[model samples]
Target: MEMERLDRRGLWMAVGAFVLWGVMPLYWHLLKAVPSLQIIAHRIVWSTLLVAGWLFWKYGRGWLRETLAHPRAAWMLALSGGLIAFNWGLYIWAVNAGHVVETSLGYFINPLLNVVLGVVVLKERLNRVQWTSVAIATGGVLWLTANYGSFPWIALSLAASFGAYGLIRKLVGVPPVRGLGVESLYLVLPALALLLWGETHGEGGFVAHGGVAAWGWIAGALLVFGGVLTALPLIGFADAVKRIPYSMVGVLQYIAPTLQLLCGVLVLGEAFDRDRAIGFGFIWLALALYAGDGLLRGRTAASAAAVDT
Candidate 1:
């Protein structure tokens, strides 16, 4: 019972972490003056350094050695690294490009995308409610696309990439912080290469005003703070996954996206047109269905498990 209680506490912590993650637009807003690509690059570079330092401090050099020891793990880490970088880049771009609302829309739709991933990749079965939620969510997305006369490809890309990244993380059994450390290491090389290339041929690199103080300070701060900030929620999430079911996490994930959507429409002054309203309404309905399905399934599973015991 004590153990169960501890786990539940940890799960709540995880939920809190996710909530912090949802509030990230507030952070990005601070860096709004910086170019999105520059912000993205700083995120990569700084996060890598921070994670590296922490991993070394916590696990010593041996941890780094072990991460590189297994080729398969290394490959998975590399792929995950690339995917997350793209995700970060796209997210930064979305926020800076006044598409924060749509970015939030992508996250709002992510759980459903995860459901689709589960069905297609994990071969998991969805009951009637789940199926209905999926259908409704699909309808919502389609409606949004129809309204625009073009697909919200950016939104879809973020959702799909992130869903895939989650699936890959599930498949790879590395511990959260250490695994993330390895992923950062994989990204470091490319990031450095680009930084070098940009300095020489692209845009003079790092120094925003011909010295390290201009945008360099901002970039540096972002790099270090970005990784540490990201790591906090991730660690919290890892703790939560151990204590709480994935279904619970899925439910909580909506908090961040919902906030992002609001920030977009309310703060950033993004349009919430009539068509968008209609589509969002349908999406909300889909989320309701999805939440209901998860709850019902969880109760049934608990009952069955009790009976078995």
Candidate 2:
């Protein structure tokens, strides 16, 4: 009963995290008037300050020193930091530019890309079912490219950048909070510089021009609140992962992109014609196959272990 209750709590936490992520396009949309670079700068700078402040409060002055105790931590976090920054910038651009649907496609494709990364970089092997699923997903991408009248580079780029970030993190294996704190720290200087440059150039989103009051108080508050929006869900996700099975997490991951798709179509009123639907159909089929295969394999292994015991 206790374990079941814990799982319930963890499941809700994961749901909240994914729900927040799924609806984040709306948050970015609220800042559509802001230049993507400026928005990214605010996100990095504010999130760095917020995350670092918490880390210091929780772990004291030497927290950072302990975080970097691993000789390679600094450099590895730098690389991951760069990748995540790129992902964040592009994602905000896509969302605000009315490519929210394509951004949804990117996340839908991300898990499959992770598998390809595993095979290529980690030398991990995929079984026949997994291989078939990947092949079908590839076909889905091809179909979209061939029929959708334009290359979905936004989606592909988002997937690739995030996949590389995950690969880097996996190779180094640092705790999530410590890694994020270091990554944010590494980006703080550049983010601050960008914000400085933007304000001086008369194009910053944070402030109004002389006596103009263009952005207003609400927008400014949302810009600062971007830090909380960015970090809180991630922290919840980390905690949820600690409390649940990875397979459960994997299944729940789809909730994010699915909600993103709904938000794009229903709330944002983006186009979702038959061609895109057909392509998404293929990808969905592939995911169903892959997930079903995983469940079957997991159950079989568990049953065999039970017999042995």
Candidate 3:
């Protein structure tokens, strides 16, 4: 009963986290007047501050020292940090530039991309179902490209960058919050430099111009709030992973992109015609196959272990 309760709690937590992520396009939309690059810079700066402070409060600085002492981890984190930064900047730009639907497409395909990365980079073998799913997804992408008269580079770039980030984090094996903290720290210098350049050039959002009252203060507050937005969902996700079976979590992950798709079509009024619908149909079929295969394999493996024991 206790375990069941815990699982239920975790499910809710995961749902909340994914829902927050799904609706985040709305938050970024509010900051549309701010340049995407500047928003990313502020995100890095403020998230570093928030996470670092939490670490200090929890562990009293020992974690930071230990993390910094490992040269290999630092290098790996640096690369991951760059990838995440690129992903964030692109996502913010995409959301505000009316590419929310394309952004949704990116996340919808992200899990399959993770499977491909695992095979290529981690030397993992895929079963026949997984292989077929990948092939179908590839065909879907091809169909979208051909129909659209060009590549869906925005979606592809978001998926590839995030997949690479996940691959690196899997190999390195760091705690989620701490890993993100370290990545944020690694990015701080560049982010600070960009903010400084923007301010000096009279283009920074956090400063007032033309006698606008309290503009700088409001912008600064919103920028710091970005850190809270970044960290809260991460905390929920980390908690969820501890209490739920990963297969369930995998299925739940789709909630985010589904919400994003709804936001794009219903809320933001983005175009969604027959061509895109056909392309998405193929991708959805592939995901259903992939997830069904995983569940079957998991149950089979558990049953085999039970018999052996």
Ranking by TM-score, best first?
2, 1, 3
Residue 145's lDDT in candidate 1? 72
- Runs in model 1 deviating more than 4 A are 1-14, 68-71, 193-223, 236-251, 293-309
lDDT of 2 at 53: 88
Residue 218 lDDT in model 1? Answer: 70
Per-prediction TM-score: 0.81, 0.83, 0.81
Model 1, 300: alpha-carbon shift in Å?
6.6
- The sequence of per-residue lDDT tens digits that candidate 3 reaches over residues 1-309 is 477578779889889988998999988887776778888999888888898888989988788778767657788888988998999899999999999988887876676666666666666677788788778877876776678656789988987887677666666656667777888889999999999987777657677644323455877677779978877776676666556654345446667877888899999999888988888788778778877887798679778878999
Which has the higher lDDT value, candidate number 2 or candidate number 3?
2
Ten residues in sequence with the least summed lDDT for candidate 2: 245-254
Q: What digit string (tens of lDDT, one per residue) describes model 2 on residues 100-187?
A: 8888888777766666666776676778987888788778767876786678899889878876776666666556677788899999
Alpha-carbon RMSD of each model? 3.8, 3.8, 4.2
Q: How many collisions per candidate?
A: 2, 0, 0
Ranking by lDDT: 2, 3, 1
